[model samples]
Target: MRVFAQLFEAIDSSTKTSRKVAAMVDYFDRVSDEEKLFAVALLIGNKPKRPVATTSLREWASALAGIPSWLFEESYYAVGDLGETLTLLMPQQSRPEETPTLKAVFATMTALRKYSPMEQRETLYTFWTTLRGTALFLFNKMLTGSLRVGVSRKLVINALARHLDRDEATVAHQLMGKWDPLTTRFTDLFPQQGTALPHHIPYPFYLAYALDREPADLGDINNWLLEKKLDGIRGQLIRRNGELFIWSRGEDLLTDKFPEFGPLTTLLPDGTVIDGEIIPWKDGHPLPFARMQTRIGRKNLSAKMLQEVPLVMVCFDLLEYEGRDIRHEPLLIRRAQLAALIDNPALQRILLRSEEMAFPDWQAAADFRERARQFHCEGLMLKQWQSAYGVGRRKGDWWKWKADPFSIDAVMIYAQSGHGRRANLYTDYTFAVWDGDTLVPFAKAYSGLTDTEIKSLDRWIKQNTVEKFGPVRRVKPVHVFEIGFEGVQASNRHKSGVALRFPRMLRWRLDKTAAEANTKDDLLDLLRLYGQ
Candidate 1:
């Protein structure tokens, strides 16, 4: 536990990628095989279920610190983090003579879930006394299921690749699919010899970066393959060993969740994997993303719900064919094969080819992009015809040219402290639009501001606070910001009778006043234009 905590601190304290990778590599080299497997899993977002309730922990910590609950709440609000607040409030203690291993800690957490409340409190008290400083903070974070660090999954994969003398892509692919880190050995994950991978495992998705320059800047139009960027879940549909599996880009096994595509197991040949978007389709058009959300997180799909929000896999790329990996082949050849494979009438029932756009030049491409919203698509994807299907995100091969977001000037009416690095600053804000003489909260945004701008606004927020509501402060509506969002829809759950998708602050409109902000009527107009 101490070593893992040290690794966390080393990675968090440094901003350089090389330093972080070195720290991870050194840690991985020193740990046991089981410990290494668990470490990799934790770093790559496979955290265990939280073992204790946050309210119980807060109560226990306050009692141990000899402080009242209200005082603890105030400290938590000021700190902007529950784990940090608990760690600081507890009395300092000496380090244990023998620190527990990471595996032992995980075991204790698993046991605590079955323990009674009193037993759980006693175990936590023992942990608080033995662990100190960063170790204690990390323990609290794990208990709260908020163990986040400054490193990316790619950095960890790079470190593993360096430590094992393996290709980075190979290391990434080995980490894909569902595997129990507690039982699996590190060697089992990355074998020294050639070993067969699980039949259900999927290849790492190829992501595209946003287009920052003009389409003409990318050279000849014929060199790029254009397809509409559908606003749906990006998934890999695999037909392996007479079984169909649908895995999301997040590495979730969603075969059971999307049983509508089960026919592909018989229709598609064995050892075939296709990358596509799982969209909610009906009446020969894509449904709104909001409609798709209804089917998400639902384990048991009713017949009515399935009928209302029908699904289809819009395939774009072929990763494997005839039980052989063909990611190195040029995309044009792969597309030709994918088209031929998906041409059958039975396969066409649940699968549709992502039609490529035929454009003479950049101007015609832009015109097609403008029609993306009409088809419920996000934008157009431009892929190099001759580029290979690479792992993770790579530049120069593919780009996503999205339509401009809907923008509106709104007033900042509520402010809250941020988490992690921005914990001490008022970085989160709720914006409102005019409803007659009233300012109705419409959207909340926390990004797109420079560090200097955040600091300046933090100072302003501290001075202009009107009222306090626990962690949130009802600030005076004096500041205006231009908020940008991809789409808008009517929502009865929101007080404004609408909701914004992917809303963020575009810029601080310092010249505008609260009264000059947009109105609820304007939001309704947007809903009428864009809402399904």
Candidate 2:
């Protein structure tokens, strides 16, 4: 535990990516088999279920320390972290000179496989209480899923192979399979050395970063492919041993959510891994994101919920197919193979593709993306035909070419105090545009405002409130600011010429004069540019 804690501290303190990767590699080189496995799991972010209640940590600390719940409540004020409070309460002993490797700890956790889920939870909680402050913080960070250490998964994978004296690619491929550090097979592979075996897990896609931009000069839309940015969950579909497993981009297993797609296992070739977006589809067209959101967290959805949000898996890329890795294959060729294999209409479709003639230049792609609002698509995706599925945002392989957000400069017409810390001050804002020289409010925004700005404006809003509308207080329209949005569409419900899509206050423009605020003409111009 102390060893893993030190590794975590090393990772946390390292600012450079190279340093962080080295720290992880060094830690992996030193831990036991079980601990190594657990460390790997922690690195890749696979943990058991979390407690249902926010106060569960406090309960664990209370029970472990033999202190009453009230005592914890009082101490919590002094030490904000539950684990920190427990560390302070526990009796001091000589710190162990030999810290167990990540492999050993993970092996221990996994070796107690006979324990029930409740027992496992209790055991984990007990283990957490025994750690020192730094170790405890590291464990909590890994458990909750954010390490904040800036190392990339690719770098870590490389470091692992370098330390183990194995092929990095082979090691990376092995890491993707089922992980259990304490297994006899795992222990045998690494031997019971200083470290057992490092935990191996798949990397999260959303967190991957791209290195560079595609040249603004790629002519011919055929050289690139544009995809609708579907407002659905991103997922990776993995097939092994005649069963299909659907994993959300958030790393949540969504296999049971859409049981209709269960038949896909038999249809798809062996060892196939596909990446694409998952949305609830019925008949032909797409369903609202709200419908899909409804089916998300429930362990077992009611039959009614499944029937309502019946899902469709849109296969986009064939990462691996039929015991063969095709991620290195050209996208167009892989796409052709994908179409031929998954002939089910429910599985594949030639998504609206841009004509080869239209996107001969960046301006054209930008124009098409700007007009994508008409087709209910978010933006475009640009891919190089020769690029490989190299992980960690390799340049040239892929690019998400999104249209710049729609924006307008408007005047702040009202403000109010936010809840919790800002309850005594006004931080929320109601903004307006110029309507024939008159200020008319169209939308209200609370987020995107900075803490310093919120507190400062909160004081002013309270002093300048001209009128009250229940919880909202109308204030003098003296501040002019810029707001950004994804898109704009006509809305009869709104008094303004248009309604903003995902409107967010970008920044304060105090230097600008109130007369410079957007006018009715400006709104009309934006509505026209919305390409409806």
Candidate 3:
């Protein structure tokens, strides 16, 4: 536990990637096999389930600190982090050279879930009193399931590859599957030493840069491939050895959830991997993203539900063919192969190609982006004709030029503190549209605001707060701001009878008041305008 805490401090203290990689390698060399596995899992977003509720933890912590609960709440609001607040409130104690191992400590936490809440609280109180400084903070963070430091997942993979003198892709593929920290050893992670991996594993996704300018800013239009930008979940469909696997861009195995794509196992030949977008389709048109949400997170799909919300994979690129990786090939070659395969009668219904549009000039591509909504696409995807498939973000070879977002005026209704650096400020907010004389909450936006703007709004929110619900404050809806989004849909869950995708504050409307905010009907009109 002490070594892990030191590792956390080392990671948190550095901002440079080189320093972070060195810190991870230094700690990796000092811990046991189980400790190394546990640390790897935590760093890569594989945290264990929190055994106790946060409210109970706050109460127990306050009692141990000999402070009132209200005082603790105020400190928490000021600190903007429960774990940090509790760690600071606890009196510093003597440090011990050795403590419990990371695995043993984690086992104690998981076992506490079987005990009564009172018993659990007592155990936590005793543990808090024993641990001090960085160790206490580590325990609090692990218990609350918020143990993220500055170190990123990519940095961890890079460090492992450099230490073992192995390829980065091989290290990433080994960490791709559902791994158990309790059973998997540190050496087990790299037994292959960068050799062949299991057939079901999906390759790392290739990303694009945002093109904020005209396509003509580059070179001749003939050197690029332009396709309509899809508004769906990016995924990869793997067909190997007569079995199929579907992996979301988030690295989730989704084959069972999307059984409609199961026919691909027999339709496509063995040893082929196709990359595409998983979209909600109806009558040959892409439906709103809300329709796609209905099919997500469900293992069992009824016949009626499946019929109501059908799915299709719009092929984007070909990653593998005939039991070999073809990512080294040119873009046009991969597209031609993918097109030929999708032309089959049995596979044509489930898989569709993203047909490239011909443009005589750059102005033609710019004009197409303006009318992207007409074809139910986000914008245009511009790729170089000879660019090879690569991992992660690489500039110049590919770009996504999305259409301007739909914007509307709305009022801030709720405010909450942010995490990390913004924890001391009420930077997160919920916006609302006018429904007759009352304000109805619709979308929550926390980004796209300048740091200066956030500071000003944070001060205003504290003064205008009319009611408080825990960390949330119901502020006076006097200020108006413009909200921008990509799409809108009807939702029974929201009070405004609407839901907006990727909502963010475009700009503050200092000239407008709450009365000038848009109406709920106006949003509904937008829903209609965007094929909601």
Question: Candidates sorted by lDDT, descending order?
Answer: 1, 3, 2
For residue 357, give model 1's deviation from the true position in Å.
0.3
For residues 309-373, could you state the per-residue lDDT of candidate 1 as single tens digits?
A: 99999999999999989999999999999999999998887999998989999999998787778
Q: Which residue segments of model 2 deviate by more than 4 Å?
A: 48-133, 136-150, 167-169, 177-215, 299-308, 344-361, 406-505, 508-532
Segments of candidate 3 deviating more than 4 angstroms? 29-33, 91-98, 109-119
Q: Report per-prediction Cα RMSD to one decimal.
A: 1.3, 8.2, 2.4
| lDDT score for residue 91 of model 2 | 48
Per-residue CA lDDT of model 2 for 1-532, tens digit only, reads: 6876777677767678788778887887776555666666666655433332336555765776688988877665334344345556654435443344455444444444556656755765555545557665554543433334445557767777777777665556555544444453544443433442322223335222221454465545567665666657777787776777887766667777777768776766667777777877776766756567668867788889877878776666777777666777887877777667776654453221222224556776667777766655566666766555665455555766655677789998877545423445566677889888688777677788788988778778768889876456788888888988775666676567576767888888898978898876687787786533
Candidate with top TM-score is 1
Residues 225-283 of candidate 3: C-alpha lDDT, one tens digit per residue: 99889888899999998899999888988888887888898888887999889898888
Residue 200 Cα positional deviation in candidate 3, in Å, after optimal superposition: 1.9
Question: What's the TM-score of each model vs. the native?
Answer: 0.98, 0.65, 0.93
- Candidate 2, residue 238: CA error in Å? 3.8
Question: lDDT of each model, Cα atoms only?
Answer: 0.90, 0.64, 0.85
Comparing 2 and 3 by lDDT, which wins? 3
Q: How close is candidate 3 to the true structure, as a TM-score?
A: 0.93
